[model samples]
Target: MGERKLLSPEIVQVTVDKVNIIQAKLKAVQDRQKSYGDVRRKDLKFEELSRVHDVFHISMLRKYISDPSHVLETPEIELRDDLSYEEQPVQILGREEKRLRNKIIALVKVLRRNQIVEEATWEREDQMRSQYPYLFQN
Candidate 1:
């Protein structure tokens, strides 16, 4: 029979180092996912606020444009000429809304990509855990 083999100290140390490196990489990926989620949330909130602002501005402009005499009586319509500038606000809001929407779409795409990567990693981890429960068990 062949002699029994034993792991040398250097080999054991290398194995431990590899495991630690894998664990650190996994943690970094998880942290990155969390950061992306937080950024997405903030973008959503900003989009919502921008939508509200746009709607309010549109409503006010509509009121002034549709009934100039009545709105002027309220003293809020101080300058009739400013109505010409209303279109600019609408255009600006439209551009901002579009930008925010695009950002949201981009963020969602990134999140989906991250999820796919994480899912694959999780599956591999699960398989490893099942195959080597003793090694993974705390």
Candidate 2:
């Protein structure tokens, strides 16, 4: 069989250019993935808050049902009575949950924006890959 000839210089140049463009696109995708990771982490914080809120709500409901009058008049006093004197920790945690919930909402908005950016990036990447299937075909 005849020996295979090397790629022409023009073909080599074109391949290099294509590779550079793909590399740039890949970097952009990676940056977007990182942004998504950040947003996902923030989402977890909200999920955690949701869990705490659910528990607190249940406990508050139980207290109200058990002692409606106390709960109605001087809820603050009843709340304090319901918790131990070392309740400072619980109060701090509640505050943290609220803060996390607010932050998580903000992050969700950012995530939605990133989703649009990511979709555009993926569309471009898919277009390039389709145009030069050999470049990305595994």
Candidate 3:
């Protein structure tokens, strides 16, 4: 004999909480974009690039992404209140970009679990070989 399980109120509440959390994250990203558009940076083209440039400083990003211990070894950043408002967006972008990268990794794992490889692959190796940052750089 099999028993039927019923949904508890706590489980329903947890689902609702998760949705709310996701909505808040989306709103935060939208807010960052709006503020970004409002700012004027001569070096940056707002229309061409949005938050994607957040991690353009690859060296700093790699330190955080690949070597967490190194980042932890640095002096505490929170105690320094000397940071400017302009610096906030850059930090936000780096964090969001890292989150996006992590999500991509997670997605790849899910795809593998489903017995599916990449959605699209390079048809030719020669064609796929392209220039590095130079190709996409300003």
Candidate 4:
């Protein structure tokens, strides 16, 4: 094991002086960085106009109170092992016949579960009937 030297008063003073020097340099660096930020910052003043209502007191502004109705409740969707969930048709919105090159194809606007009216997709009526037999029971 190496021999440890006993700390003298002079050696302790020297170490404290070195630490103070380092702290002074660090403080100077921090002040210089703060001065750079101060240089970029400016006071904003709005001019008073006859008809313009630009600035108002903090008391004049009303705090936004969010309504419970504004929050949309999303229905829970079950996922399979592949992270893909099957979409179930809620109801048939409308039916349309598309004239193809040779035959007339029947299309249905299927309102899927958890989907909005605008998000409803047009699927083949025959395909929807085969898949969801409960839909055509009525």
RMSD of every prediction:
32.3, 31.0, 32.2, 14.8
Runs in model 3 deviating more than 4 A are 1-4, 41-138
Give TM-scores for every candidate, taking all chains together and pairing residue i with residue i: 0.28, 0.28, 0.26, 0.47
Candidates ranked, most accurate by TM-score first: 4, 1, 2, 3
Residues 1-138 of candidate 1: C-alpha lDDT, one tens digit per residue: 999989999999999999999999999999999999888774434333444333455455543356555643332333366553221110000111114534521111111121333332212334434544553334
Better of 3 and 4 by lDDT: 4
Of the candidates shown, which would achieve the greatest TM-score relative to the real structure? 4
Clashing pairs in 3: none
lDDT value, candidate 3, whole model:
0.43
Q: Count the backbone clashes (under 3 Å) in each candidate.
A: 0, 0, 0, 0
Please give the lDDT score for candidate 2.
Answer: 0.45
TM-score of 2: 0.28
Q: Which ranges in model 2 have alpha carbons more than 4 Å from their true place?
A: 42-138
In candidate 1, how many clashes are counted?
Answer: 0
**lDDT (0-100) at residue 39 of candidate 2?**
80
Give candidate 3's TM-score. Answer: 0.26
Candidate 4: tens digits of C-alpha lDDT, residues 1-138: 999999999999999999999999999999999999999999999987779667978999898898878988777889899999988898999999999999999999999888899999999999999999898888
TM match of model 1 to true structure: 0.28
- lDDT agreement with native, every candidate: 0.45, 0.45, 0.43, 0.93
Worst 10 residues of 4 by lDDT: 47-56
